[model samples]
Target: MTTTTRTIPFKADHVGSLLRPERLHKARKQFNRREIKAVDLRKVENEEIKRVVDRQIEIGLDVVTDGEFRRTWFHLDFMEHFNGIEGYVPKKGYQFADGVETERYDVRNTGKITFNSKHPFLKDFKELNEIVDGRAVAKQTIPSPNQFFNAGIQNEDIYPDIEDFAQDVIKAYQEAIQAFYDAGVRYLQLDDVYIAGLSAPDIPFNDGKYTREYLIDLALRVVNGSLENKPEDLYVTTHLCRGNYRSTWAFSGGYDIIAPTLLANEKVDGFFLEYDDERSGGFEPLKHIPKDGPKVVLGLVTSKSGELEDRDEVFRRVHEASAYVPLAQLCLSPQCGFASTHHGNELTEEEQWNKLKYVVELSKELWG
Candidate 1:
């Protein structure tokens, strides 16, 4: 196995989505309500996203993203592109930790899941690549195969066999990955928050039909399968998170339960793990990361609130984690995206920028 350093093994990175600027948010709302033409909305999104990309470059980030400006929710927007999937609102919304809930909806697959050439996010990545112009690398983030698994079986009648259903999901993701690579993407991240959720003590994760261990094995299989046949130059990373919705979380726990399976066996270039607060538990679980395994991106800063963390404290925590995993196999980022959804967290735009600036500065101080 190759343990050599890879190109995408950068010192600093991010979870991708940024808080939508008020102007872009307004345009999206207007377009959704049919108050403006799609062309006009694109004009606004294009302008704002250009600024977001520019800021990423200007702030000295290793990879730049479109800030996921095209959609309302990070995962659903991409999932909706699959052939038979659709979302519908129920009487309740998505519930997060701290008893916080929002007007979120559930997605369902009316038919088979497959990648479409006209996938909007793929198109979005293409546009961002053009804007990047080599000043910085362009990165793309997609929901993990486990995301489909955790969303529950909306199409069980069509895919009664669990293995068969997972294979289809794997095929869809593999196609999506290749399409992304064909679009000039050398670095891609699969956001696999569900894996972290499974580690939470509060989460039972088991219904009488499927045990938690069974589901986890299936998730790992699906993730690795989707990564099969990837190009040599492609750098694939997985970001694990408990949850993030408007400064509230959904679960709490460390990477202990999954470290052995996810950190040790997963076929990826790196892991962007959340370790910002007590809820994430201790870094002891990091021991499961093999000596020559994929690099670890330590999320030492919290993205839920705008409040800045002390630089010394953050550095201290970074070193603390190095005890379990070598410092050479580490990177730095926020606990999660500042805005997993367009609504964004409770932080202001200024605070968000400051958080990123801290990451850039900290990365240079330690890794440079």
Candidate 2:
């Protein structure tokens, strides 16, 4: 691959969510037990979010998020706010690696899904925007439209045809993208585990109704459709990981199976891909990424553990990936968020900050 001198933005990026602080976690539990009011809970969330945002800027990151402090699950908190979707507790939890199962909280499609004009997250973003005050790019992260297909319970009575369900999800996300842009958000990210799951050799919950290719095509359609007519200046991206709950992953595979379509055709500004361990497979599939396509943020450092990665090894891997895509098109980040859920990964908050500090330092040494 040829190299270019073009400068990539957010060279040291992250997959959005950060570990929830102990105070925030305690506040959430108190609120859950009716010991505190919703407003009181929000006050705690705001304080913690501000603290995290300040740390992100102080660490030399140009982009910052609310650290997903007000959320329980990184995706569900945002997804449940959509019209016709309601949060519920399921009997069974999601089984992660090493016998770790997620909590029973999940969302279900109760009726026709549509974007809620008064979506709570808009207010959430607005608060973060005010706190940021242009100090750094305020990024809003939500679950991908495709996530509805796999993560949510569809009401067959309300939507007998799966295609119809997909269309509603597409439209809802389209409105959501526009909504965030209107809410003073310049950078937005979609956290998608569904697409990554589809890359697996044998999909776990495949009912044999839809082929893998069909699902992949649908994912492209949903994601690209959501970006339709998005503001020219709005920076949108997607982060894909097999699964990240309490440091245990749900699937194992590479980008090879879906790269030709996902990496090449997704209408986004960048892609944050998981590549922290052998389970993510090789970088050969990155060759499918077009020269002029989205910038690839390689997640070479592991967020699941507190152990720091070998700096030289990370540098070498970046060069190896550049064999497929140009050096100028590549960026650096953790394999995934330090926390995809409020429970977080197997690391302390101090370790999380160190990991991000490592990324920022490494990017300067490599890209500067």
Candidate 3:
């Protein structure tokens, strides 16, 4: 375990993509239909993204992303850029129960996880690098190998063997991570909603002799295996979320269920945890945070809705968490992105900035 006394105080989250105005969305649809060349769509998206990045910097954010401008959503768009993967409509569509009805989409299969320079993600980052002011750290987020592997199973095609799938996905990401580093991205976060599935009691992965602990070990192994021998300069982290769609969640559980393994086992620079609501449980689990390793970015602000958290109350929560981990090791941000998918959640654009401004203000108040 390595510890750095030097603290980097900042505010940022999976802030890229889905800010695509209606025109860009139309262009992307046309490109997908092959009615227009990808280059044409890329040109428009590039210009629009630059505007978004500039706004992020102008608003006083320490880190900036491309607003996932070119992406349909974080996972689908990223997976679409890869080769060995293919998307097909599932026989029985995914269904999530969250009061209001919503259906899940098709799962991904590892047709191939090879690296290709032509991936639009490269261009996306390069353009972001050029526009993002040097003063602000540029960050990129990708679906964790866990999220990728879990997506490989569609409907009833239960993978008889997961290790084969896990290793392949890891290799694919290892290639992607190396490429991102070569392209000059330092801070990379692996977003994995499946991390929370480790705690869901109804889920079969945790039933029988396979306790939740045992399954979590498997999940971590899959992702950590992908990160083995990664570049030392790359500041890798993981974001654990219950599930975020249109400001509604898919699962509810406490960090107490998975903290020991996550805080102690998973190898990464940090863990961005969803702590904006009561469903995440109390701060006691944070005591398990390694005193010697892995920074914890408390997602103490909610991104689901536009409601700005009470500033003084947020400060009090940060102070309360500091009792377990040093204040120096803590950071703040929204629990998740304003739009985890294409719809951009239920908040207006103005609400999104207001929520982000609250994060920037709160972060400066604590660490500054």
Candidate 4:
């Protein structure tokens, strides 16, 4: 594998949406009631994802995500694609301390060895490459290792021991990553908001069982354990979001808590950090980042709303962050995707494309 690094001064993010149409809602309702089979729903997802990828390239996006179009929620939807994984829908629903309620049923992994019948990621990437007219990077997003750990503990019937469960989860993830690499995808991003929430005093890792240092060690092990001996040219990264659902947030804390680990220890090519507001705190903590490795993508714009970001202000923050990491080692994008899940956030599809246009415009003016 070549260790060649390319810097074309392009800007992009981790993952994107699947552009679900209103018909999906009606179809999903049918699926929920047993009126339609899961196979048909998958077909809808494929068609929508194709449109999403085409639109992204037409808008001049440097990298395109399948738009997570087929997913109900990012993490669980992907986990459900695996065998032995089932959703545990609660009667009243588990409540976020932030007062937000999630309709998603918690996910659990069964120990039985069952792989995905067909890798959706492989099919989508292949389709995207065929249809897009120009050269654009292709990416696939999966939940972080910590996400799998959390999912395993969501229900008790699947696995009695969380540690053993984590082992199984890690094995499964390693397999999934390898499969994506084999399918010709070079960029893989692990979507993780769990670390950001852990920085808060309210909810801690493993239910507050570990301190910040311990949690960092655990996070490193989980991420790096699965990453061991992979293809060198395959670039893996992580995108951190406070939370984005219907324009509502789920956590509030600065990078101060996770700076040491997030900057120095976490293994990945770049970090997609949310710096859209004060919720992300100051940039001083970024100084802890090791100078020798990984690019840092400055997430200075907001995808929560359609309002365009002040380009000047975005540039200001970018330079401020550059105080630690060099500008050449940096890139820019929204704090998170417009629709982290299939709900598509509170903004319209037009707004999403406009926001991306701003990223491209700003990146060109600043970096060019």
Candidate 5:
């Protein structure tokens, strides 16, 4: 079992967020309407966090998060909070597949980009660090450098050159990583969905000055850059996401297209990869992972649906992927978070818990 004594990259882990509960939804609405104060809202948030964290421990997870209960979008809330960046709704909504539309709000660098200690997540991490009973290690999740860059489109007036822009981003992430470490976060997960989306066949992104390939190359470089000089004890990993919205998906394709470059070059401790459906291609591309490279977490279980996958069948898939990477170097998780957004997947909360409980049980079956 992975514990404080064991390094992270644990046998069974889910992407950090769980579906938001009803009370949390109501509290936000209340706060938005000024029916409650921020302090009152935090009281509610803290209470729910206790309940959720206890459930995660009871579910037998070695790694736990605060369920991202305080935020709306996982990537946006964290990235937009960075110093020198400000948020606004874009001219058009982000059009995902199946015509799912979301208000296209984004960030732009209004001044020289920098890291601020008041970047709320560090405070959030400190609270979670205190909340966990120390039975299960609390892990913090942050948006990757690529996600930050993708969210904040390049402003020629602000950054004349892409490389010049990347330097600030790299420095900001380096600072953020250190801040989280200082706050007692030893296991951090960088959620980099855009990088995985870039690998898909369709290039659905807003890029007026940069090509898809150019953006992809820059994302790879910046992510690796942020990881430079990370503390040796902190286990920093990444979840390569395909869009997860209410059981819907945005990008389709395999890591094959980006594997040789992104996976081989990425210096993180491990990868949480999506392999829940045919949309994510075969495990053959996993062979490209260098022998000394980061380990892999086989995201074989689906967070998009409520139906729990069969245990034997799940193991069958793990064994199949092991043909490319050693089983010893692999772990299991959901393809993505049950709630990448506050609305979460189509499943009931009970179903979501069952899915996590299943991963814990399955990991024990395979790894113990």
Candidate 6:
């Protein structure tokens, strides 16, 4: 296997979010019920974040994140902080496999979407950076601009044309990139479900208003637009997953549909792709990835379950993918974050750590 010394996209990397500890879960509930003040909740969150950060470093990870410990849902929390967006209970929750439905909470546009200069996540990263204090690379994750389209443009009156709405989103994300870069985040990840969702034949995207290809192209435009002025030193990547809620998934398909466009054109440092099972299809599409372009961090391990993956299987798959992209351009990670939401997957906290530790060990065996 090809080996190299790179810190940003480590051989053993993870998509940011980690499972929330029981105490933090309790603290959130208490704060929601008004049983404790916001300050009290913040204190609990701070303590939990520090502990998780330490655990990540202890497990031999080169990069660490806040584990998204402060939020309930991964994307909604970050989106709602943007101006002109508000959270509300949707008429129905997202339908996952086996008829499993997610929580009803979702975000919508109220007027015009703009990045809040004082976005809470800036402070969140600042606190995380202070805690890390050069011990490890502190990576920050947020939703991709394409997610807003998946959320749907609720107020068409404010944005009569879809193109206009898309432009504003691109601008908002551009500001967000700058904001985070200013806040001292050198590594950033944009968690994306929408672009990958287009590949799932199960979902009827755009409702006949646009073809799958059209939507995919539009999504790529927004993503690339957001990165237009991103600082060269700020390493940005995207994590694409089908869905993660209570150990269930919403869509099932292959990268074959979106691979040519997404893998070939999307401008980013790397792509954290979901390839845990057959649902994501074969690695043939990876051939479209440019040889010298972004590194492909293969998500060969599953995060939804507690059982460990066979080490040999993972190694075989890594080499298999190298047939399309060189082994030197490959890395390993879980298909997605252990906990994309506060509810998390079915795995226990101990199992989650074990899963990550396994990734580290596998990296050492393969690359070192």
Highest TM-score: give the candidate number.
6
Tell me the TM-score of each prediction against the true structure. 0.96, 0.96, 0.89, 0.87, 0.95, 0.97
Candidate 2 lDDT (Cα, whole model)?
Answer: 0.88
* Winning candidate number (lDDT): 6
Clashing pairs in 5: none
lDDT tens string, model 3, 44-135?
88788777777777777767787777665577667756766666666563444556444445446555456566877876787788877475
- Encode model 6's per-residue lDDT on 98-193: one tens digit a residue: 999888888888988899999999999999999988888889999989889874645787987888999999999999999999999889999999
Give the C-alpha lDDT of model 1.
0.84
Position 97, candidate 3: lDDT: 50
Q: Is candidate 4 or candidate 6 better by lDDT?
A: 6
Across 99-166, the per-residue lDDT of candidate 4 in tens digits comes to 86767577765545345748565676666555543457777777887776552343456566555655
- Which sections of candidate 3 miss by over 4 Å? 1-18, 30-36, 97-104, 110-113, 151-159, 207-211
What tens-digit string does per-residue lDDT give for candidate 2 at 1-368? 11111332389988888999889989989988999999999999999999999999999888888988878898888888999898899998888888888998899999999999999899999999899887877888899888898754789889999889988998888888888889987788888899999899867545677788888999999898888878888888889988999889998989898999999899888899999999889999999888978899999999999989999999999999999999989999998988888899999889999999999999999999
The better candidate by lDDT, 4 or 5, is 5
Assess each prediction's global lDDT (C-alpha) against the native. Answer: 0.84, 0.88, 0.73, 0.71, 0.86, 0.90
Which RMSD does model 1 reach against the true structure?
2.7
Off by over 4 Å in 2: 1-9, 204-206
What would the per-residue lDDT of candidate 1 be over residues 194-236, giving only the tens digit for each residue?
A: 8887788777767687887887787789899999978889999
RMSD of each: 2.7, 3.3, 3.7, 3.4, 1.9, 2.4
Candidate 6 accuracy as lDDT? 0.90
Pairs that collide, model 1: none
